[model samples]
Target: MSGFVVMGITAFAASAYVTLDMSQARPEVHGPAHYGLLVAHIFTGTVAVVAGVSQFWPGLRSRHPRVHRVMGRVYFAAVLPSALLGIVCAQLSFYGLATSGPLTVLSVLWFASAAQGLRTARRRRFGAHRIWMIRGFALTSAAVTGRLWGLLLGGLLPDADGLLVFTTANWLSFVVNLLVAEWWIQSRGYTRALPSEALKPSISSRSAQSSASVA
Candidate 1:
């Protein structure tokens, strides 16, 4: 987990380094609005990546539950704008529909995962929340994996069609990440908690409140 955190943060740093350069903004592609969207996407996506990883840290979650909750909210908030902007950016990409198609799908799924994660968490379905959040972060990690895929594909098939490479990379990015997430969830026993187990936290909190009221 620690290693994963380091890798996530490193990926964010690399993304920022590469994308945050104003000089690299291709206004000619889709004009100034696209540039703004890219900036917003990268910044909010960074927030999601960082907060998402923090939510998974055992020490942080155990010792600092309040902090965990706060960061979870942060992650949720960041994911919305980031994913929405990603979709817009994809549609407007000069790369045309071939490359944009998979990316648009990825952004939509990313948004849905974040929404589902928050819904489960709100219902006090902690185990389901964990699973959904894992899925959410898996999609978020596509920002990293997508780049890696592009690099690998580019290197392996230097003469490959650019459109094919971009499309393949975009699809593999979230597909592979989600597959790994599913495997980890099952192996780690993160399936939905039993009904009783799911209710324990809420019941305990209510009992504490009752005791305080009586006293």
Candidate 2:
């Protein structure tokens, strides 16, 4: 997990360098509006990636509750705006809807997962909250995984169509990530408490009932 976080940060750093430095001579964006949204997307996305990873560090939450809570807030705060801007920027993608469509779908899922995580946390459903947040982080990690996929595929099939590879990676990145998250949840035995179970009598209450029945 730590290795993954480090890889994510490294990828983000490389991308940020190319994005923010004018000397990099990056390809042109559509116009000022598109450029602005893209910039906002990058900034908020960076924040989300940085803060989101810390929330899952093995001992961070239990060892430092205050830091965990603060970073958790920062993660959700950044992710919402990042996802929103990502959708607009996706529509303006130079790669066309082929790439943009998948990206937009990713952003929508990212937003929903983060929102649900926040909602569950507020309702004091910590188990559900952790699961949803894991989903959210998986979606967010697509920024790294998508680039990794692109690089790996592009290298393996140098003659392949660029658009095809890009589109496939965009879809696979988040889809695979979410699938892995579900697997992890199940493997770890993370179960959501049912509404009925929440209302079930406590063990002590059951014991008391047993005594009274015996009497």
Candidate 3:
């Protein structure tokens, strides 16, 4: 429910931004070409985020594998193009390399993670695919998390320079999310499972079954 709320709010905000006229867009993106890429990135990115969140829902994947596969396709299709456009938009950012550098790196990471997810899925390595997709989703969610960090920073340091706060928040958003995701995967024992082992019953379960047979 909380995830839905966050995704909804972020989607609403992104959709609103994309709909804004050139005159209403940021000064740096007033040019038609730049604005178009920005809009494209936002729209496709919003789709990716929404789709990615649904992909993580265990019930949906476990009960409706077809839906999961479809959603995964949508996520990859949307995210790959979105990340590419994002790289271009980042390069054109008014904040220059300070902001663009980190954003560009993030875009690259986003594309790589999504591509890795696709590769793993194609190889039928569902466990590795899930982890990579989670990484990709965390990067995608940077759009929301970055703004959140900005808001928190704004509230805490009302007098801080806006650009400085934004740059800091931007870096923290994806970096922190990725770190937390890695920690979650480790804590869940996901990293210890082999690609083939993932879909099989656990050793403990087999042991229990054997003991039951003996009884």
Candidate 4:
């Protein structure tokens, strides 16, 4: 329920921003090229958010593996392009280094995590794949967290400078989400459960049974 609400709000917000004219964009993204990149970022980023959320649902994966796989593909497809466009946009940010620096780092991490997830999945190391995907999705959620933080800070400190608010929000957005993802992965035992180790016991059990029958 909460996830749905967050996704709905994020989709609406991104759509709204994408529809805005170049002149209405932030000073750093006011030009036509930057505006177009922003639109692509928003569209693909929204697809990532939606696809990522579905990928995490255990019911969907357990009951409908095909759907899960499709969603996984969609998630990666959306994340890669979105992260690339985001890096370019961050580089062109008018908000100066303070704001762009963290976002630039975030874009790199986002792409790397998503790529790692894809790699792990292809290797059939599902536990590792889940961990990496969770990390990627956490970073992707920055768009929503950034806005929430901005709203809170803006209301609390109406006189604060815009750049300061943006900088603080940008840092907290991905950092907090990634930290929480790490914690969740640990709590779920995904980090501890390697595919080889999980198969070892079963293989050893089968060998023991075979030896006993021979005896």
lDDT of model 1 at position 22: 61
TM-score for all predictions?
Answer: 0.81, 0.83, 0.87, 0.87
Model 3 residue 20 lDDT? Answer: 61
Kindly list the per-residue Cα lDDT of model 4 for residues 1-215, writing each as its tens digit.
75797698787677566656666554456577788998888889999999999997889999999999999999999999999998998888766799779899999999999999999999998878989998998998998998899899999999999889989989999999999999998898886676566556687799999999999
Report the CA-based lDDT of candidate 2 relative to the real structure. 0.83
| Decoy 2 TM-score against native | 0.83
Q: What is the lDDT of residue 89 in candidate 2?
A: 79
Give the distance in Å from residue 63's predicted Cα in candidate 2 to where it truly belongs: 1.5
- Whole-model lDDT per candidate: 0.84, 0.83, 0.87, 0.88
Instruction: Count backbone clashes in candidate 3.
Output: 0
lDDT of 1 at 202: 83
What's the lDDT for residue 102 in model 4? 89
Worst 10 residues of 4 by lDDT: 21-30
- Looking at model 1, the pairs that clash are none
Q: Relative to the unseen true structure, what is the C-alpha lDDT of residue 43 in candidate 4, on a scale of 0 to 100?
A: 86
Candidate 3 segments exceeding 4 Å error: 18-20, 195-215
Whole-model lDDT, model 1: 0.84
| Candidate 4, backbone clash total | 0
